[model samples]
Target: MKSSLRILAALAPLLLAACAPQQLVRHQGDAASLAQQDAREKQLAHADHWTLQGHLFVSNGQDGNGGTVTWTQNGDRYEFILRAPITGKSFRLTGGPDGAELDGLDGGPQTGPDAEALMRRVLNWDVPLGQLRAWVMGTRAAQGGVAQLSFDDNRLLSSLQQDGWDITYPAWDTTHQPPLPAKVFARKPPFMVKLSIQSWTMQ
Candidate 1:
């Protein structure tokens, strides 16, 4: 269930190989077992509104390129825009990952497949939008049957193992109303997406 995401050049093409420390956060009790408590925590941090800017990429055992995605989540409604460098030109794309609406510089009201195609035209590679948000936030979807979840000293979602996928969060600041992720790592081999939140806006 991967969709194409476009990467901006100024922020793209930086998919160089880099390794980070294998970190483990201590949080007692299985979170999945405490659905109500976990849900409470999610509601507590509560993202009434969230906006972030960063580079994103996906790999399938091939060369990957990074793209810039400016995402803003307003309550349940969201707006996601992507831009990537390809063939010495920059293409802009704006839409919602959960199928909100589409407004692109390329024109035409596009659907999911169409939007994905538009970004691929500029990024020169396919992007996985579904995974992008999950990685950026350092959390999994509420639908995911989380086997276990833990928090770090920062009270941020530190680690999660949902549906056999391992996720790690480092450096989080809830100073924002919706909370902001400093960095997130989603490792599942062949598709390890890492993100660094450059700036955050909460309202």
Candidate 2:
């Protein structure tokens, strides 16, 4: 019995060493996946001309609005339209490098130098349109530096922290070339925006 115990003890160190190689391989695989993901993000960053139809929900701790949303983007120009069937409220935001315009509101048409400022003043909604342009496409914003990022098992973006917002991608449309986000949720304290994308059209 004493000799048998000694043999088992001697094999324990060898067994542990065998597992070390597997651990190293797993670590290497993770690194490779991250590298691939980074390359994919670079490609998506340049994808500026596309349209997406989705559902958007926004909340500011108390008041909330939910509706069907359609966003069309062409280079730096974009047109965003939202329709709330239950409330019979709707709005359209169209903008480019020159300026921005918001229509279908109480005070009639409103124009400003930027979309974010216009929406904040007219609708009282704190939305980061510039940053969101990239985020909605599953890439980090070009301006604000990202604080952290996490990936799912498929090496797709799972969650990220950037510009004071915690953004998460719960699902992806794997049918696309590089895959696109199907559901995106972003929160910053009292403000939260959730998007459920139904279709994407690339140009």
Candidate 3:
């Protein structure tokens, strides 16, 4: 029994080492892959046509609203539609070089030069549509604002801040090629928006 105890004690260190997890190492290959992904993201930034279907939740200090969102982007033009199933109300916002037009089931079309400001006044939701175009792609907006960004172990964007908004990518579509954000949350003081993307189609 004494010899058996001694043998087991001698093997403990080996057993412990075998059970330990391997240390993660970042090498040149990892750096190259990250650079390639960065280049791809930059290419996607210039994408002229794309469509996204998703569910969105928006909240302000007073109330919270949720609905389906369908956004289509074409060059400098964009069309955004939001619908609240509970109330059966829908709003459409379109913007181009001319200006921005917002229409809803409750009122006539409202026109303005800025879509973000228009949505805030019309729907009472302060949504930054221009910055969102880049943010939704897991990249920061190029408006030259101070940005703070973080990456996950996979070298994918985990969170970012720009233009007074803090955005988090809690989940992504890893099953698809060039993984895209699956769930995102953006927040500013008194306002917050959450998005769950159902489908993405790029043209």
Candidate 4:
């Protein structure tokens, strides 16, 4: 426990280092990314509740698997629940950096390497479950990333960019719509994450 905390603590400063204003303003993506970041932040401040269900494919996208994710945010903190289907076996994980207990896992404090851990390092986002939930859904939280966001239809948060990484959302609903799956495409060379919106609803 102590070692994990120390590792995370040590990481905090490095993460902050990457968040210098210059990085955010200097992303190499086209103008669309900046516009989306701005637009997404604006929409997030107004949303009450949002849930995104989709097919999550990782590790080169050849896994041929799917999953559903639901996010609920009351305020600064939110809960992201993910259930993944891989090779006929199902696994679920719930919890964020700020949360003490993940809902459906039993073992020790998972102090090992995993996809989520990699994302935390690569993205430098360690907000509570709800905070990230909101950001992904278009809310701006305390994430230190050289990021820019853009929106489509001027409401639903559209795209985001951080540290040479970028996400482009193609399908978006403009008029305060629901049941819209905001697809975000991420690129970072050998690592890619493609998320598809399968369902959306208010809770």
TM-score against truth, every candidate: 0.60, 0.82, 0.77, 0.52
Task: Give the worst 10-residue stretch by lDDT in candidate 3.
Answer: 11-20
> What is candidate 4's lDDT per residue for 101-202, written digit by digit as tens?
233333333332332453364334342333334434544454545556554443334455554554555555443433233554545444445556556666
Using lDDT as the yardstick, the better of models 1 and 4 is: 1
Q: Which candidate comes out best when scored by lDDT?
A: 2
Cα-lDDT of candidate 4: 0.42
Which candidate achieves the best TM-score against the true structure?
Answer: 2
Off by over 4 Å in 2: 1-29
Clashes of each: 9, 0, 0, 7
Q: What is the full ranking by lDDT, best candidate first? A: 2, 3, 1, 4
Clashing pairs in 2: none
Could you give me the TM-score of model 2 versus the true structure?
Answer: 0.82
Report the alpha-carbon TM-score of model 3 versus the true structure: 0.77
Q: What lDDT tens digits, residue by residue, belong to model 1 across residues 1-203? A: 01233334212212211233356565644545345335544754455477887765544345455566566767655565555545333334444445423444344444444444544554443444443445456545555454466766545566666554566666676675446566665555454556666777766
Local error of candidate 1 at residue 147 (angstroms) = 3.7
Candidate 3: global Cα-lDDT? 0.62
